[model samples]
Target: MQSQDVARRPAPSSPAGPVVEVEQAEAALVEHYPRLVRIAYLVLPSRMGRCRRVLTAHSLTQRALPRARTPAPAIPSRPAGRDGDPGYALVRLQVVRTALEAGLPLRRRAWPKRAQLPSPLPQVWGLKLFPRSGGADELALDQRLSALSGPARAACVLRGLERLPDGDVREVLTAAGVADADAALAEADRGGAEHRLLDSAEFDPCSLQARPTDLLRRRRRLNATLVAGAALAVCGALLGPPGDGWGPDGAAAPPYARNPAAQAALDPGRLTRVSPTAWRTSARVDFSVWPARGDLTDDTALLRRALAVWARPGGSVQVSATPGTPSGGPAGPPQLLYAGTVDNARVVILHDGLRIARYAEPADGTRGAALDFARVDGAGRAGSSAVVLGRTDGNVRYLTAPWVRGAGERDLREPGAAATDIALTGGVTPPLPSPALTSGPCTSWNVLQLTDGTGTRLVTDLGELVPAGLTAGRPGAAEAAAGAEALRTWAPFACSLRAVRSAGVRSVNAWAFAEQPLPDAGGSAAWVCTRAETWRGGGARVLAQFHTPGGRFGAVTARAEDVPACGAREPRVLAGVLWKSGAGTWYLLAAGSRDTVSVRATGGVEGSARGRLLTVRAEQGARADLKGTLEDGRTVSGLR
Candidate 1:
């Protein structure tokens, strides 16, 4: 039959009922389903970057459908190039809003530690990572996108990826709760400018995963804890409890106060994995590599290119090369030594030399070889860092320290027999005016120098280098110095008591740790700080509030009387005092064990407190806890 015959065949109508309306709704949905999923895939903030279009798109569509539908009105269709139908725009906007609100908290809570990317040489920025290349590169791109704050990511996706107009972008961001959509858009634009793909390239659309048959199976599940013959129920804590009440002074505490576990749940990036099961507070990595050469006469062009390949922006590592000789030996064929810093703490010295020798052999055609490595150094800070050395072979090494063989500095081991010309390949060679090969106390920053037949190249670190003198003139060092002085003066307690490394000012953050020795619960009872105040100069004055899963809460304060006198064993405690301005700005003067103390914080509400004292009941190798009340009469106890 002709198409007109099929169109006229619908004259045999069925009785009006829920089934008929549902069938009409399903037909309409099927017609528009692809576009809806595309929009959702671009907009939904899946922290892991998982495909959720099939799940969330349908949910949003069903929500907007009318319950009492009168044979679903025909959708007003438009040209494919235009914004489609006005009705579609309205529904799409609703989906976008729901995606942002529902998916914000679910954003990736932790970044899988990744090595710094090679520098963007010849080009200032790295190549745009293509989703078509589904491997480490794609993971890297996903990581970068996931790092952005919620509103910033939304703006970037809508305006940059989806090519939405400015008006539409603004509306989307504003709906996502961004106060200043313009500023957010600008920031996102700047951040994404360097990473956008070139127009000449193209990629295939990602294949969609299979959809589940039953997506709307809503079932209620409850978790109960039995203690002392009573059941305590925990449910829907992330959405929070019912009431919105104020403290006695009209100050606000978080609504989910009683549930410390929920309060402790921070945005994934803020939580640093301390061990296999524990997390500490910290900032994301901001990576940079500085290329250095002692004198201008040395050829360093090749060195620059090689260093460029190693320096990726916003990576956790700050790798620098220096000219070094083998242990107790003469300058062994000019070597470029390297150092690694993970999260602005712990520095591992590259002891072995990447010996580059002249070989009059043909290019083996093998790309590079990688070797797994481990830390062979001191305690505590040992094995917390990772490094990978790409050699003249094609294989890439995977290294996460503390548990690998060949426990020594990474040697970008040159392929021995199948060798070729090192100079032509831009490998790490020796530099001029050789640097002193000495390992000492951890400093504010570290330096790395690379050299080859082309010339010697100096690489400055993104983080501050130790001894201060080494950081002269390389670029961005003066600002680092100023920030260093600020941190030293404003938060001396942190400088003295907590272990810190010099991170670039752009990525600096404060972490507060209130530790108690709880041998029964693994090793120590460490509480993440829940409040902080940044000083005008540099460092932050932090507030360590102690709260247990068992319903005890208190703040850390400084008081001389509360600390144990010099030799008193039973009352061996550390304490500090806070002086608050009338405006509620608080300053802290603190002291504690020089070796064991460190500061950490995550997702804390910022506020001011007056008449506060930080008293820590601590004994050298015994249990410790935070005690004392704020001027507002909030107290915490029963921490075991």
Candidate 2:
């Protein structure tokens, strides 16, 4: 029922010993046991387990390594077969033997000290032999290789050195490095008969393709040369002189100088003109013609007279004259002339170079009348006007003027009910009153009475009206008795009281007295009144008093709250008292003009009678000095 196809199989090689070459081992490993030790080492740790498992799995120990003298098992050869059919075991073994021989020796020679053979020796061998240096030498190598075209360089480095993955090698060579190295390496890798493929005519594909790197380098060099050439041309053009019908000097002439009309327009003479006129001068009296344009001789005489008039002490007048005439006329009369007005008439003259008329009041006898007309009342006497005429007795006379109704001249000899009024003539208006003594008290209401260097009176109540304290320095016994009685009654507590007459004056002109109240009757109080004649033919009266509380009073205390209600002008107050509770214990409080006072109880008896004290006053703000006393008899003397 079955037909057996007995296919002839090649003989299998025996396993070799440890001295077997790496090439033969590689062949055996690839053909017979592609992953034999790798699979065993994954599961076991011992070499015995690896050997046992490999031998048991392949039934190779009895067939190849029975006594270690024989070599390890080679890969069996493949049998003759149709496409896709399994080959003979003997053919696989022979192929393994061939590859092991070629690869084993190479691995041993390249790495003689390695204890164990590494897998994939051919690929590793390629990588080890390839130089990894990436410096100038590598750059030179890259350049030299690049000259052979992209495909050539790619195939040489990829297949010979990098040994890149198959897919990448194919893509890089085909897309970029289209060179014959692809066919050369492919043929060399194919075994036996296929090695002849490198010699074919189709292997020269790299020679037919353009080298992109060389093309790029050439283009860059060409562009640099072109750029340099262009720059040189531009520099030459710029450095050369201007050409193509430009001016000989190669600069345009000024616009104004090129046009005569423009130059003429800019000339100053054409823009404006100046004309000269004769100098002019004038005088006051000759109103007919000003000296500027009139008969020069007559004008000069009048001018001299006018100058004499103003030359008087404290007299002055101003005159103005115009120089030119418009319309180019024969220079009309001085266009305007003004003379000081005498009396009440302001004089102006309009002369046509020949005649003059004065529109002024005549300076006849009325000049005296005009001077007397402007008078003023004397000081403190209204309506009694006086003329300011120099007196015949070398004294100025504020001569009284007679009153007149309406706008008529008044007589200076007889004024009305008012006193003398001084008259101011010429340009003066009225006379000011002379300085005299004013009849009023200086500050206090003390009356003053003065005589012209003769006598003085101080009319104050300290004399006759207030007999409680009056003293007069007199030689008469009656006057002395009267003075003593007044001092005893008014100042009974005073320590002393007397009235002494001036030593040099037998007239009993000066007085001296002193009085102070007794300390036991409360502190001393004193009052002094004086009457004296001033150097200015005037008199002055003054009164002053001083008072202090008695020594029996207690120390004055102060607090901030009590200061506001204190009836003192300055916010701070001063307090002083006599006696203390002990030698070192005394209460004294004093504050300067601007200072505040404050106190705090410090380790003192709280409920004792001495603590129940009153505050006199305290300064209101920080100042250099503050004064206050404590109930315990301590005083704040000054800021510490």
Which candidate leads in TM-score?
Answer: 1
Task: Name the TM-score of candidate 2.
Answer: 0.11
How well does each candidate superpose onto the true structure, as a TM-score?
Answer: 0.26, 0.11
Candidate 1 local lDDT, 1-640, one digit each (tens) = 0111111111212222223254444554556655554454444443322423334444554454435534311222233543344344444444455545444321134331111111122121222111233555444545555555545656766665456777767755554345566776776776663234311112112233232321111110011113312422334342356564232436657655554433222122222122321112223210111111112113233222222222221222222221121112112112222322222111112221221111011111111211111111221111122223221111222122222122111111111112121221112222211111212322222222223222222222221121111111111222221223322222212221112122111122222333443322323323322111111113322233332333222334432221112111221223433323234443332223222232211122212222222322222323223343422344423121
lDDT of predicted model 2: 0.25
Q: Cα miss at 452, model 2 (Å)?
A: 28
Model 1 Cα displacement at 44 (Å)? 3.3
Per-residue CA lDDT of model 2 for 1-640, tens digit only, reads 0001100121233333234444444444445342222221111112112222222223221122222223433222222221111121222222222211211122323432121223232122111111122455444443343233223323343444323444544443332213233453363244122212222222211112211222322454466569979999987877675664333544666544555544332332232111111111222112222112112213333333332222221112221111111111112222223233322232322222321222222221111111101101111111111112221111221222122111112111122211222233321223222111112222112111111121211111111100111223311211221223332222321211111111100111112222333322333432222222211111222111122343211111222211211222222223222223223333322221123223322222111112212222222321223334443454433222
Off by over 4 Å in 2: 1-485, 489-543, 547-640
Reference-based lDDT, each prediction: 0.29, 0.25
Query: Candidate 1: minimum summed lDDT over ten consecutive residues — where?
Result: 215-224
